[model samples]
Structure formats: C-alpha cells, structure tokens
Target: MSQTVNALEVKASPASNQTGYRSFELGSFAFSRDEYFAKVTWHVGGQKLSHVMSADAFLRAMMRDVAWGFFYGWVNFDPVIGTRNLYGKVELYAGAYHPAYKEKGLDLTETFDSREIMATFKAILDDWTNEGFDPFAAPDETDTTWVGKKNGNNRLAIERQRQACKRMPGLAGDAELRTDKNGYPVNRAFADVSQEEPEVHAEPGFEDEVHAFSLFAYLSRSDVTWNPSVSSVLERSLCCPTTEEYILPIKHGNDRVEWFIQLSDQIEWEIEDKQTGAPRAKVIMKAGDVAAMPADIRHQGYSKKRSMLLVWENATPGLPELYESGKLKPNPVEF
Candidate 1:
C-alpha cells in the first residue's frame, strides 16, 4: 500500500500594510492556519540575514542551519494562543547537508525535496505579512511566568541524569571530543565549534554559557532513520524547567559531550568568548528557531513572556549516574 503525503500548495497576496510583504497559505489541512513570523540576525563579521517562514519552513531552515554553519533564527505568531514567540534549538551536525554530501555522503533525496521545502518557507513569510498578525506583541509577562519556572525544573532533572551517567566504565571514549584538521581538541567538545570562530559571538556584556543538557531524538525522514547516538553518547536531552545555565569550557581533555533541546518560547543566547576577547555577533531569534553550539561555544537563556520548553539530552553512559554521586560539581550555572 502506498502512503499519502501532503502536497505543496501556496497562494500569495499583497499585504494590507503596503510594505511589499505577501500572505500565504498556512497549512495543507483545514484545521491549520498560517501565522506571522520573522527571523533576523547579524553575525560576528557583520553580515545581516532575515527570513519569514511558516512554522514548517522555520523548522527546515533550522535543520539546514545546523547541517551547514549559518545564522538562522525566527520569531513567530501562535494564533491559537494569541501571542508572539521566540525559541532556539541546536542542530548536531554542523555540516549535515554540505555540498560534499550531495555526491559522497548521506542521500537526502528520498527524505527531502528542495521544492517542497521552499514552498513551506514561502508560505510562512506570506502569512506573516498578509495575515494581519503581529510577531512582537506577545501577551503580558505575568500571565506566563509560572510556565517558565516549570520548564526550569525539567531542565535540571535531565542534567542530573547526565552527570550520573559519566561515571560508568566504557561510557567515556575518544569520540566524545571534536578534533581539528590535525586531530586536536576543538574547544573541548564538538558543541563548541561555533564559539572558536570569531563570526559567531553575541553582544557586549553577554557571555556565552553552554547548555549542559544534550538533545538526541529521531525524526523519521522519508529515506532513513536519523540517529545521532551511533556517533555520540548523549542521545536526546530536554531543556524545560530544571536547567538554568551550562558552561562549555576550553578543552583540556576532561570535558563531557552535552547538547540541548530548546522547546517552544525559550530563548538560547550567543556572545563573544571572554578569554579570547573576540567581538560579539548579533542574534535575532523568533518563534520556532533552532540552533546548535559546539562544546566550547557560549550561550545563555531567554524565556518567553509566558511559555514552556522541553529540552532533551543524550550523554556518555556513566555521566548521569555520577551526578547522583558526591563528585558532581556544585551549583552548576543555569540558563
């Protein structure tokens, strides 16, 4: 039996504000609707980029950004809740979809089509400009404060689990650390790659803090099962209420591999490396944005005026168990 998939259908119309933006179809089914969304940011080198994508386009772009190294973020409207939103999630593969992959690497043809991806992206932009929605006017902060604290609790539990797992024998391996062209520590862990490059920092007084949690889950693509676990230990970690701050230090051979799952409305920040004295990069994240930082990279947290996030992690086997032991570091930073 053949399985049915949704088709790409789009309709573009001039926006009511006369700003030259257009409205587009939001979803393939009747219950779905398009909402206003925007992603704008400036990199450390001073390059500006922006994109207006629907929720779906925002996801795909984020996937691409993690696969290829680039500044990709977004701000979106949630019609169901009547609010503007912000979010960020890390992509594990920094070069997941490189040109080299087209001929010599993972075959994405069966899983993703360029045309469909573009259609989704266009629809998001069109809906924002023409749908009479605002991406900045979120609800009052007081109404959403409780949800934020709840998410913080969830984040903390996941990190404690990872800290415990680090102690098991055979859980630690050479693969945990990212190596350079000559095979040296690339900023302690693979997650820190973005921090070493001068082009990925944030604003002044904003230092980057690592998300101690790691995120690893399965997204069923049309062709294959994308599993990050085969390569690294930290599989899927969530960033909800339990986590506050994470630190990814310069590699000295004793760092752990950590990742973060940035759920809806939570903000992950970026900034310059304090030790290196590099200039900061500009970050503009909207609702539905996902980005990843290497272990050495620094990032912080930005909560929505009202909302919750689910962060996931996949850590080296014995690390989680170690946190339960007395050896775990005290008062780890929160994001």
Candidate 2:
C-alpha cells in the first residue's frame, strides 16, 4: 500500500483592523505572523528544496549558512502582488548549490543574464495572487510535479555552468580565492622584510576592566565580505570571541565614575556600593540585549559570550585623542 502524504498549504486573510483597499498589501505565501523572519523550507519529491524570507533575514541566515559566502540578486517588487510601499523589495541570494562562475574557468568580467529566473519568480507570484492559489501549497509530490520539473531544469542549467567553471584554468583558482577568508592574493611581488615590535609596559597601579557593547550596521554594498582579521582591530574597544568589549574611566573632583555597556545574553548584574558597602540594585538584561550606562554609574561587564561595544565619552576631544594615541594613561579601575 502506498503511504499517503499530507500536502502543505498556504492560507491568506486580511490583516486585522485593516479595511478597504490599499495601494498594496503585505502577505507571505508560506509565512505566518508567529514565524516572522523564520526559515520556510520547501520540499518536493521527498527532497528538501529552496527557502525564502525577508531580505534582511535572508542575508543574515545565508551568511550563517555558508559562513558569509554568496552572491545576491537585486530585489524587484511587483505592486500587483501582496506588498505595500517598500514591501515589494525582496532580496534574492544564491542558493548553496548555485554555480560560482568564477570558480569554473570563466573570466572575472564575464556576465550571465538572470532575466529568466527573475521572470519565473514573477510568474510564480502572479499565478499565486491571480489564481488565488495558496502559496504554501506543495508543488507536487512526484518528479512530474511543476516545482520538481522546474527544479530539474534549473539543476541542469546549474550543472552546465559548473562545467564551464571546471573547463577554465585560472577560474577555479579565482573562485577559491574569492571564498578564501584572507581575500584573493594579489599578483604583485615584492622583496620580503621583517619587523620588530616595540616594548610596552602598563603602570604598576593600573587595573584591567571589561566593558561590552553591540554593533549595528547595514550592508551598504552587495558584496559584503566579513573579514575576521579586520574586525580584530576593534578588540581593544570591543572584545568577544564573536564580539568585542572596552572600558572607560572618568574622574571628577575627588571622585571617579565609570560606565559600561554589556552586550550579550539576558542576565542580572549585582554590584557592591563602594561607600555604603551594601548590595546595589540588580540590573537585568535578556538575551539579544543592549544597555547604556549612566554617566555617574559605574558598571562592570558580564556576559556569557564575548560582546562588541562602542563607547561614547564626555571627556575633552583632545584628551580622548591623546589617550587613544597612547600619550595619556588610562585611568585604572578595580573590578
């Protein structure tokens, strides 16, 4: 007896409190409110296939998947589909098996048109909204299904591209270099030289302290290459295996102040009052947390993971510049 397979389906409804007609609508073929930014996997013929989501979420997820190696297509939104202003923009990135043309024996400057793929995606959207078909509906269970058939065709195109890459001599090397962490090796040659480090010492009375913060930035460029080495330079201010941290101290007439920003998991902090020697109020931060320290409040870093922090000081620009330049000594702080 053949086993019965439950087909997936998508259901759409008007957003709550929304009425009348608007220029555009925002809805997902397979996404639910509860699963916002969540991965939606599509399967056909018992084989897992493509996934899609918001562009920002997609970029981050894809980076996590390949450790930050992939190309993307420009987002083209259609007003006829269920997206409002700014909602039509969707980012399309390379799938894991997508061919890296430069990896094969292709010239770096060679270009391939992605017009057909874009058209197919647009057609899919048009069919969904026009036919009132559920976007979540499974394409088909067998190889003869629409999605399976298209995927099979796409796979062939991908394979042909892969072959082209293999035929090129320098192409494979270039592709490998593109995926390399250190970056592609420039062909420029030069004589080798050695360098020595200068001696450095910390003051006898100085104490080390840890601070934490978060980094939020947008990918201004399409080719976003995250270089761990470049990120290492920020270690002095932000320290984490995956993040960074820093410490800053302030002094006033006969008094001192410190502030800290701990960017990490959710937790509570406890400190001892210096003057009263009493338990201070507990500070709590949940996972995916960010907090700012008060100018008068002294804070300590505490997080399960290393955190990246950005510090904004109120000191004189000249003084801070001197400190950063290693001319002025950093005030000591005891944990």
RMSD of each: 22.1, 24.1
Summed backbone clashes in each candidate are: 82, 18
Cα miss at 102, model 1 (Å)? 45
Candidate 2 runs further than 4 Å off: 1-264, 287-292, 295-297, 317-335
Cα error, candidate 1, residue 103 (Å): 47
lDDT of 2 at 146: 23
After TM-score superposition, the amount by which residue 63's alpha carbon in candidate 1 deviates from its true location, in angstroms, is: 34
- After superposition, the stretches of candidate 1 with alpha carbons farther than 4 Å from their true spots are 1-257, 266-268, 277-284, 304-306, 317-335
Q: Pick the candidate with the highest lDDT.
A: 1
Per-residue CA lDDT of candidate 1, range 1-335, in tens? Answer: 11112465544444435333343432211112223333322122243322233443332232222221122111111111110011122112111223342234431211223344344443432233222221111222012221111111111111111112222111333223222432322221123223231243646654333112122111110011011222223344422222211211111111122334443334445543322213355343444554433323223344432222233343345542354353554224446
Estimate the TM-score of every prediction.
Answer: 0.21, 0.20
lDDT (10s digit) by residue, model 2, range 49-147: 333454323222222222211111111111001110111233232221123321332211112223322232322232222121112111121122222
